[model samples]
Target: MSMAPAVDAGLALLILGLGLWIIAARSNFAAVVGFMTYGLMLALVWVRLTAVDVAMTEAALGAGLTGVLLLGAAARLPAEAPGGGPGAGLRVLVAVLCVGVAAALAGVVLSLPEPAPSLAPLVAENLPPTGVKNPVTGVLLAHRAIDTLLETVVLIPALIGVWALAADRAWGARPGALTPRPSSSSLTLLAQVLPPFGILVGVHLVWAGADEPGGKFQGAAVLAAMWVLVVMAGLADLPKVTNRLMRYTLVLGPLVFVAIGLAGIWTAGAFLALPAGYAKPLIVLIEVVLTLSVALMLGLLLAGPPKERA
Candidate 1:
């Protein structure tokens, strides 16, 4: 008997098993680890489907960044209590229902026709004139600039909301009577190396995005990883709300993007319409500011205002 099909089948079963484990696990930490494993496997599946861009994103965001966030949150939670109340029959029923729904979704996707015709030809025809080889980037930054501008507005206010919530004294109070000491040695050599590696990847993603699937969002995420790592390890303390730079960073993207949009209205008779010869440079400039703003916002979310430095 040929072993190729068997190998594929086994891998598929293993992925399913991991998914089930994540859903059914009683321990939050175990569930997070299982979820990270599932993400890695899903990345491999994306590669198998010839979606290198999606696979790269899944590996970076899903397996790498999400795992860090989940593990950190899990570390702060209480240990699971013994003798859980759930019965085996209830668990089985829930699992079966979940599997049924998943199977149905998979069947629907598999039954869909391949090589579906799209408006890609139209996009391709005009991409060179737009000065961006990446159709998605052109659509996002040039064709659909309004949506991008609105998204930045949404992000700025959301960060303000988070800072407001973190300001609540009761909510921000340290959980235990004893403040947990920060340990530098707790971070391994690998952790130290990871941030710089993430920065390199982020810069590459930003530059590559002009002609590829990667873009500011992906690059910003990679930069956010570095910010998160430094914050978590206590290497760099968060600035107080009183800090001028902190406030500027929080509002920078929206302020710049909106100002540019309004300027475009003056020059081009419509909001966010790039002037005849400045589309590419303006988009790149906006992306750089957006990346920095996103990194700062994510850092502030992870690290509340600096109390006494450890």
Candidate 2:
């Protein structure tokens, strides 16, 4: 706390530099890499602000998962040729517009009222009913359960959109990765070595989230990354898009959540509300199912559409 100001200044400068470089980078890959770095750095900023839950989400999903997804896209997509981009006049106009927007945002942030109208106090006051010790988890699962439910639900449609891009003949086939199976011994070794630890850490994160800074989303991202790495190394294969078990597994979380939510109307008198005295168990059950479904969905999304038939 004593040296907070200096730390904040340094972090802010570093983030600003990363943001500028990401915008200025000529290559798409470079910009994506810089974006991932910026996300991780911003996670540190979140931590310094005493928001560990948000920091975990930022580090795991924003940086870790998104970085991998974009890198894979960069590998598969063709790059635009140099000088095929906007001309100087257009660039200057866009830069001016961007700067004006950034200045407006900064002004708004600076002008925000003191004693921020946050829901922290409300969440704290009602957290005990959720039967979870972590206030973030409580808010996500109990206080604002519908919002969280909708977040997971949206992933389903997004994945559907990705799969819809596949050729007709590829409808039932395994999805293609951003890159072909990498056979490098070093990559193979890393793929073989890292997953066990990654899996353990991922599970631990979900488990500890009940009372700590970690959570299902963060843990799910780690699990998804490990699966993607192994699949890319050719140690594992993605199931066909039409695989019955895989398809069912993808929807298991939301399906279960909906069932429980509807049951809540009878037992708890409100949709998405947990029955009294069983909140913790039900929440844990939902999280466990969600973790698995989310991990699979994310891995498959990163893997792209099904491979075209030969």
Candidate 3:
């Protein structure tokens, strides 16, 4: 009599309950809590499915980073006015759309072949050339480097969009703080105690990602979390939007990545292809720069639009 079945059932129930709570939650704060809990539960599901990389990503970005952003937004937003809720018809339409999508997804899953097709074997066979032991890392950095590059590039525009929210007068100002002023001593203590260890863990994740389940994204999330903690604790301030060094940090990763990809055309005969015996170092280089850029971007986004001059 294995407990695995019971555990799985309990986890599923918890996820379903949290999902419903998020959907039905009356307040933004309540909904954000439910959503973050749902994300953590989803990460556990990914772990149970043996997708450790996806689990780490879900926990880091889905639950941790996004939760912070939502919490900040909820804090800043005004309370909803009475009788300002959506119409009954609009709610019904939304519910119908949700059910329809759920049904379609269930049908697709149920219709899958007894043994679904997978390219895992093919990836395993060719993964050695990528100089990475982690199949996921190999795929992301070598076989599908172009896709990864594009993903990094997309973050730039998203950050720019956030910056664009600033008024003309606020263009050179620093972003607003995460937590309100008169910070609690407990938060300040936690910020001081946590970030040193967190930063080390973040760096370790990046260094180990080549051979293990961690990667730049997870590492960057951890680093960004530390930055957020520090800022919220009143130990640091976000750089002004017009700061030259900060602007350069924002785009450094993609620039270096593109340079490497272009160089690959001359060295390996295809864009983003690693030259023979050089894949490991090149991938590590990309990961390092990407971690910095992504961490800063996440921190800045959480910092929100510039509110006043530093």
The candidate that achieves the highest TM-score relative to the unseen native structure: 3
User: Per TM-score, what order, best first?
Assistant: 3, 2, 1
Tens-place lDDT digits, model 1, residues 41-120: 98888776666567777877688767766876788777654566568998789879988998999998888778755777
Return the TM-score for each candidate structure.
0.75, 0.92, 0.95
lDDT (10s digit) by residue, model 2, range 1-310: 8798998999999999999899889788999999999999999999999899899899988997788878877776679955687898998999999999999999988888997568888888998888899998998888889998999989999999999989888788889754545488888998999999999998998998888888889999899989988887888878889899998999999999999999999999999989999999999999999999999888888888998635
Candidate 2 clashes between residue pairs 3 or more apart in a chain or in different chains: none
Ranking by lDDT: 3, 2, 1
Candidate 2 lDDT for residue 305: 91
Which residue runs does candidate 2 get wrong by more than 4 Å? Answer: 81-83, 87-97, 178-180
**Per-residue alpha-carbon lDDT of candidate 3 for residues 154-262, written as tens digits (9 for 90 to 100):** 8888888888888888778888656445779998899999999999999999999999999999999999999888887789887888899998998999999999999
Off by over 4 Å in 3: 81-83
lDDT against the true structure, each candidate? 0.73, 0.89, 0.89
